[model samples]
Target: LVKPIELWTGKQLFSVLLRPHANMRVYVNLTVREKNYSKSGETMCPNDGFVYFRNSELICGQLGKATLGNGNKDGLYSILLRDYNAYAAAACMNKLAKLSARWIGNHGFSIGIDDVQPGGRLNENKRARILEGYGKCDELIQSYNKGMLKLQPGCDAAPTLEAHISSFLNNTRETPAKVCMEELHWRNSPLTMSQCGSKGSPIN
Candidate 1:
């Protein structure tokens, strides 16, 4: 049976958590500080920050910032948030693995772990091209964004921009327009292929 734990808030909880105990006195007090982006008074910009953790036993740190790209325009902030979340998750998994290793022999339990890589940086040239392509299709993009505003989480909606491009290309038999649509589709697709055709020729 577990004893009832006292609940405290704000300064009371802080004092309780921070105060040293008789058996194991606090040896270090580590605080992970993050910059407050609200103080900057900027709009539609990435909030850069750092994270660090230190205890009596170990210290680990990381610094990162958000990125904006055509790849995930819907959830731009998630690009950076995912990295920090992955780092925290990895740290927790490491601690769990160590604990599991100690209990393996006696408890007949083992743990397996997988690798986690950080997100890739957006390529400047590719980004520029994607932006240029979007610039050409401003009306389409605006319509797509408006449609997206109406979509709910589980709505059975078709691929917005891809479908639009496909229809546009089908309707317009112009070779140059078809090439532009193909380039846009290729840029947005998950497959890693060159934006250009054979021998580095421009799509146009």
Candidate 2:
């Protein structure tokens, strides 16, 4: 007679014991595939398995099959806040970052990821939102007046406008429009809307 098995370890013992053989084999194979691919696609089968794994890794990092991970996720902002080159570093982030054709003046936004897009994610919609949110332009102007060093992480830091823009963009997701508007307003002209009023539309 078979000995009674002790199921004390809190493992899913019943499921393991009664698992169907054919489905069990398929599940095992899938697990093996996951393991093999995760470890740099080493044990992947010949023909397409290695290729598929390699391409998937290249595209998604660890974000499963969707490449960009569901929707406009926060991972890109995380990467940017870490002081990475947004364009080059986008590869490591969730793959949704994309550049737009409408240029942000000479700088040309080094915006989103994905090989398909080229201009770097700037557009009229983004621009409009940015413009609308940054109602108070004098604050940044004041910071510039009081020495940008105060805004830096430490006493010795001297961040450029570009660097400050990057940090602001990353952290200001709720006000992405405002942050962007600030970037545009701050970077271009000395006179803000407050300073110039109706005539002070900086883009003009």
Pick the TM-score winner. 2
Instruction: Provide the lDDT at 88 for model 2.
Output: 31
Q: Go through the candidates in order and give each one's C-alpha lDDT.
A: 0.35, 0.33
Per-residue accuracy of model 1 over 38-123 as CA lDDT, tens digit each:
23423322322222223322122211121112333222123223534544434433554565476565665222231111122323
Residue lDDT tens for model 2, 6-107: 444312321232232334321111111211133354444421122122211221122222212233233323323344455433443332322212234435
lDDT of 1: 0.35
Model 1 TM-score relative to the real fold:
0.16
Model 2 misplaced regions, further than 4 Å: 1-24, 29-125, 132-138, 155-157, 160-162, 171-204
* TM-score of candidate 2 against the unseen true structure: 0.23
In model 2, the worst 10-residue window by lDDT is 26-35
lDDT of 2 at 168: 55
Evaluate residue 76 in candidate 2 and report its C-alpha lDDT on the 0 to 100 scale. 28
| Models, CA RMSD each | 19.6, 21.1
Off by over 4 Å in 1: 1-21, 33-97, 100-136, 140-204
